[model samples]
Target: MSLASTSLEYIAYFSEIVLAIIIGLAVGAVVMWIGGYDPWQAYYQLFVPSLTTPYGIYMTLSFATPIILTGLTFAIGVRAGLFNIGAEGQMYMGALGAVLYGAVSLPFFAYLPMEFLTGILLAVLWGFIAGWLKAYKGVNEVVSTIMLNWIAYWIVETMRVYVIPNPIDASKTVSVPPSGRLPLLIPNTELSVGYIIAVLAAVLMYFILWKTVIGYEIRVVGYNPTAARYAGINVRKVALYSFILGGVTSGLAGVCEVAGRPPSYAITTGLSNLVNLGFDGLTVSLVGANHPLGIILSSILIGAMKAGSRNMQIFAHVPLEMVQTVQGIIIIALSVPGVVRLIIRRIRR
Candidate 1:
């Protein structure tokens, strides 16, 4: 494509996302008006406090950390022609691996690396199961991953309750040891080095996908597996690589959540702290056009909304469900273009 054409395409793509945001906000405003709330005031409270304050920015980045990694997982799968929803399960395995930190004693440097390695390996194993089933056994990845997710959930739950329960508080798993905990990036805030690491991971993914031979093969396979094979690219290997890379990133997400998040550095028996993050990442990935760089921006936006929801409730008296409805509307609107493209491709095939 010519430079002018490429520029035009970029403009159009961004314009679509902007339009979707407008539509979502307009619809949300109408909903708020009907609910007897001042729409303008509600929106102001929802955005300003979260975007304009230092503490809010810190919280937003902190919340953005894990979702960024999870979103990368989904984005990688999409780039490799897979609708991999296995990040949830892989993340569970990763969290379990990180939880081992509380079970063993080690030097600070060794402990941290061990936690990350263990988590990534376990997550890769979990992802490999689905990848193997799809690549070799011809099983549908969607079905396999869905089943795996529930299995992972139960396994983690069992471990939390029976094996790693905190002696001081049985409702949660044992806390990460001080030596294993990530240092706070900002004083008196949940923000930690995890956000920085997440951003670096995004940058690394960008390099891998846009500037590497393996990435070229993966993209080719995604574009057309038959064509990729005809071009001498091993389609099955690309599929496996995609899943394993996704596993690495999602595993990091789980490890970060357990080791970086404050006041709890531990998994609750209910898994409340880690629930739905992987699913949320799917939304983030779609909104970001399944690009690593875009995902970083999208994650921050979603994180801001999450951080600001409390302010909306406290200041505007908007109900939590109402705020959630607004967020859902926004995400669905943002996702429409991606969904339509997928449908078009499937129909053509």
Candidate 2:
């Protein structure tokens, strides 16, 4: 790419980030105004505390850890010309794999590595099913993945609540043994090594996608499958690799949540807390422009919003729904850059 073109692309990215934040905040302000709340104060609670306070920082990192992995999950799929909507289901299966390992009592080294690998393999197979169908049977990946998601959900849910039954707490999966759990970063806090893994995963993903031969082929296939096929690339192989790699990252995310967060190294019976992480990952990928570094930054923003939502409610009296609204506005802005461009065009004219 030419220097000028590269510079313009950077400018456009900057514009998207600025415009999305501005639009989300502006709409959120209006919503808060209608509800007789102070938008500025609410936003302060939403953004500032996550950075300034120790506990908030820990919680934000805790939340960001998994989403970073999941964000990369979708980001990788996007780069490989696949839309992996089944990250949620793959995550569940990954959790189940780890949970099964959790039931055993092994040394720390054996348990941690084995459990994580088991989770990754399970999720990879789960995602590969959809990819295989698309590659071989001409099935729509979206339809196949969506159906696989529900199949995974019921399978895991039934196993968690009924099949295993926790022997004590029927509503939650049995906790991971201490030796199998992730090591904590801070003493007596929820912070763990998951954040470090997340950062490394992002770095590795960025390197692989931009710096490797296989990655080059995958990107080429994504950019133009016909061209790639003409060049003798095995389109089916690339597609399966894309799906499986995405699943690997997502599976790592599942084990992170299960092993990193202390005092609750168990999956719950219902989808109350673990809901829509995959969709949130899709949102993060959109907001991040599907770049690894960008994904990490966007995941941080999302983690902050989630970590601080309760504080916003308690201190600023803003409803939790307002935070959701702000996120929606951001997603809308990112999804339809034309809206921002139209406003900019009118201003220029």
Candidate 3:
């Protein structure tokens, strides 16, 4: 496609996303009004504080950190024509890998890098199972990934409670060593350099997808596997690569959550800090139109909603569930245009 056409396509997609946001907010307002709450006040509490205040923005970005990576996991899969949802399981493995960082002492320079390497390696291995199965045995990725998620949850949970249990807390894994932990970007806040890492990862992904040869192959396979194969692209390799890449990002997210986030800096007994992060990324990926750069902006928006939801409940008397409902509505609205476009594409084909 020509550059101008590509630009136009992006603009159109952006416009559609904006419209979806408007429709979702309008619908949410109606729902709030019907429930006897002041919609305007609820929205004000939901957004203004988070967007306008420095502290709130930092919190929002901190929250956005992990999801940003996980969002990339999902987005990369979609680009490769795969519905790889193994990020949840992969993230679990990643966290466990980071937890291993506390098990042994190392030099300062090696400590942090080892933590990242181990976490990413474990997540990649976990993702490999599903990828190999799908590529070689034709196993359904969705089912395999779902089962793997549960397995990862239990495995990580057992390990956290047994092998890596914090000696003092007994409810969470051992904390990352000081050298391994990401430095805080803001004093006394969860904001850390992890946010910067996430942004850089997004930028890296954009470069890969738009400018690299392998990325072009992945996109080609996604656009049409048969055509890709006929054109001499290794379809199976691309599929496997996509899953491995997903694992890389998801694992990074897990590492960041445990090593970067404040307070515990460890996985809890129930994996509370890491739970639902992968699924939430699915929403982020969709809202961002499965684009890496777009995911950054979308993650912030989603993160803001999460940060503000508490304020909405406390100040506006809006139920937290209501905020969640609005998010669901937004996701549905955002998905509609993509679904329609997909249908149209299929019809044309």
Candidate 4:
């Protein structure tokens, strides 16, 4: 393509992204107003708290850990036109993998490799099953992945309650050994080495998806499987690869949680909180146009909203559900461009 064409394409892409962000904010504002609150105050509640104290910053980073990883997982699947909805299950498997490694005999240094590898492997295994089903059994990936998630939940519940029984005292939650914990790099902060790892993962994924032939093949397959086959690419293989890759990323998110945040195994009340991570990652990827860097920025924005929502509620007397409403509005407005266009037209009229 000519340089002018390339420049125009980049401009168009960036413009769409800006529009998406604006739409998300506008919809969120509207929702907040409908709730009988000032939208600006609602926005302040969502963003201001994390900026006020060190503890708040720490909390924000802690929340961001899994989100960054899950975003990547979601990005891979969506890029390939496959809905790998079993991220919740894959995350559980990854957590199990980390826990199992922590439960065994190992040195501190060994903990890092052992935990990460175990989580990655388990998640990949889970992802592979869905991929296999789709490839050979002609099963829909959506259905297969959803089923796998249920199976994963049972698997983890079994291990948590009976098999091995990793309970922290009689609390029924197992605390990881000192060695299994991530090394904190900052004083008085929850920030850990995992943040560095998360940053690296983002960079690596960018290269994998943009600079490699495999990425090209995956994109081609995703855009048109039949055409990919005609172009001599193995669509099945690429699809399977995308699913597995997505699983690995989700597994890594589990690792971040186990290593960086909780550093212990609980019954996963955070499951509801974390499961949507994969979904959030899906949104980030979509809003970002599946660009790796874009996904990271989007993840950070979401992390900020999550971190700030509590403060917003506490300080502004805004209901916490407003945050959820805002997120929903953003999803709807961005995902349905036609609606936005209509709204814009009406406003113009």
Measured against the true structure, the TM-scores of the candidates, in listed sequence, are 0.96, 0.92, 0.94, 0.86
Model 3: lDDT of residue 273 = 92
What are the Cα lDDT values of the candidates?
A: 0.89, 0.81, 0.88, 0.73
**TM-score-superior candidate, 1 or 2:** 1
Clashes of 2: 0
When sorted by TM-score, best at the front, the candidate numbers are 1, 3, 2, 4
lDDT of 1 by residue, 2-112 (tens): 999967966777788889889988999999999899989988887887789999999888888999999999889888889999999999899989987898878877878
Tens-digit lDDT track of model 4 for 214-241: 8888777666677788999987888889
- TM-score winner between candidates 1 and 3: 1
Give the Å error, residue 281, model 4.
1.4
Best by TM-score: 1
How do the residues 248-286 of candidate 3 rate in per-residue lDDT, one tens digit apiece?
999999999999998988999689999999988887887
* Consecutive 10-residue window with the lowest summed lDDT within model 4: 337-346
Clashing pairs in 1: none
Model 2 Cα lDDT, one tens digit per residue, 232-278:
99999988988888889889888888888878788886744456787
Winner of 1 and 4 under lDDT = 1
